[model samples]
Target: MYKLFVAGALAAGALAAQLTQVSNYNNSAKAKPGMQDITFRRPWWVYVPDAVKSDALVVAIHSCQSSAQKYFQNSKIPWKQGSDRKGYVSVWPSSTTECWDVSSRASLSHDGGGDSNAIANMIKYAVGQYKIDPKKVYVTGGSSGGMMSNVMAATYPELISAVSLYSGVPAGCFVSASGASAAWNNSCSGGQSTATAQKWGDVVRNMYPGYNGTRPKMQFWHGSVDSTLSPNNYQEEVKQWTNVFEVSQTPTESKKDTPEKNYRTDDYGPNVEAIWAVGVGHSVPSHLDASEAWFGL
Candidate 1:
């Protein structure tokens, strides 16, 4: 009878472990179990599916004026529902400031003890806690979060597999700013962040010096009429990633009115792609589906 009881208890414990639900966690730079020291004490949330069929983990970052729970629960992308069906874990992280620190040198440098490093450490925590495959980790977001996605791609190339950015700028576009002003760059957002392909690629390579390895694939999206962040930033992002991939600036494949009306796609190569959503505003939730597909989630 005792043996049967023990067996039943073990079964119940396993079942509880597999339950699907959203969990909240608080972590600081002072206590890191499996990674580098995180300088910020940011809170994060995770959505675990009932059955995690794959090893993929998607880090969904919120834009400016947004929180982790707000993005996770209120996104138009049906994040929870999609995770349930797609069998991939979703992590949402809140920014310490109003926006991600993309323009700051600390955030731009590799492990330079900024919000970016804090985020990287958080991802490492998620990987170990959930037994996630490091090679399958991905990041996606809108506006400031989108820009931070590029920051992560540049600074922590080894941690991400692919990224889908919405209304973002190129890495190091706002490097001219410092302090709190780094949170928002008027010049970069005003469409003055232009550079040659080689120059932009050099900015990314400088983030992690002497590191030659496979960089993560990238997908960039922007609303053609987005005034909040000038549409020109999209073109700059294309220049940046194409140069990193050593591909031509001209796309090999161009599709018009694809996936939706007035939405165009350009494929520079397998490693780089861009989408221009016509007549849209700063942020478009409709492209979230395509972003997930890009991550193979």
Candidate 2:
């Protein structure tokens, strides 16, 4: 009886160890910060599963007024749970101010000195340190972080494979905020920012001048009724990305109730995809499964 009891206790201990949670999520992944190039305001929270398989990196940026920890701990998406199951390394990058520096010209320009450059350098360090696959690096975010995701992909197209932006405006759409606080852009967020497809594409092309390389594919998500960032930005984002990929504005394929309930999707071949969460508000629903599938993880 004593022997049996001891063996059962040992097994329970082992199971508990295997079930240890990371970032307060129910998973066997581990979380750490200060890996490389991390500063006070520009903080980072990284999660690696117990047994990594993909060797791919996913940069998950947080929404405005949210921290990396909060985003990672989000119950809706469950970052650590997905990381543990998929075996992908995930990093959560926080903004220096109220939001990422997507409005500044420095952030908009490739290799320019700003939050974008710093984040790129962090990515380089992470890639080298983790032995990550250069071809599988992806970025995703919501709201302000979503906007920064566009900036990252635009500025470092060669470094990023794809982007999943939620409720984000198009790159350069809010450049009017340059030389001002990087926090808020009244015109852009208010749905007042407008430009022709060619003009919007020109903004992205100018970010990496003279580079004719392939631009990263874009996956966009937006709540149809998102007033905080204005649902109009979604159409503008589709226009920008479609032009960048040189695809027609007309979707090659369109589907309803895809990815999630009440969510419609429009695909422009392999270059651009947009998901519209109908009747939703400031934030959309869980995009975990769809985004992972989109990243091919």
TM-score per model over all chains: 0.86, 0.86
**Poorest 10 consecutive residues of model 2 by lDDT?**
26-35
What does the lDDT come to for candidate 1? 0.81
Candidate 2 on 90-208: residue-level lDDT in tens? 87776658778776666677756667766676677668777899888999888888898998888889988988878899997778443543747788899988889998898899987
Judging by lDDT against the true structure, name the best candidate.
1
What CA root-mean-square deviation does each model show from the true structure?
5.8, 6.5
The TM-score that candidate 1 achieves is: 0.86
lDDT of each: 0.81, 0.78
List runs of model 1 lying over 4 Å from the truth.
1-38, 179-182
Native-to-model Cα distance after best TM-score fit, residue 178 in candidate 1, in Å:
3.1
Backbone clash pairs in model 1 (N, Cα, C under 3 Å; residues 3+ apart or in different chains), count? 1
Best by TM-score: 1
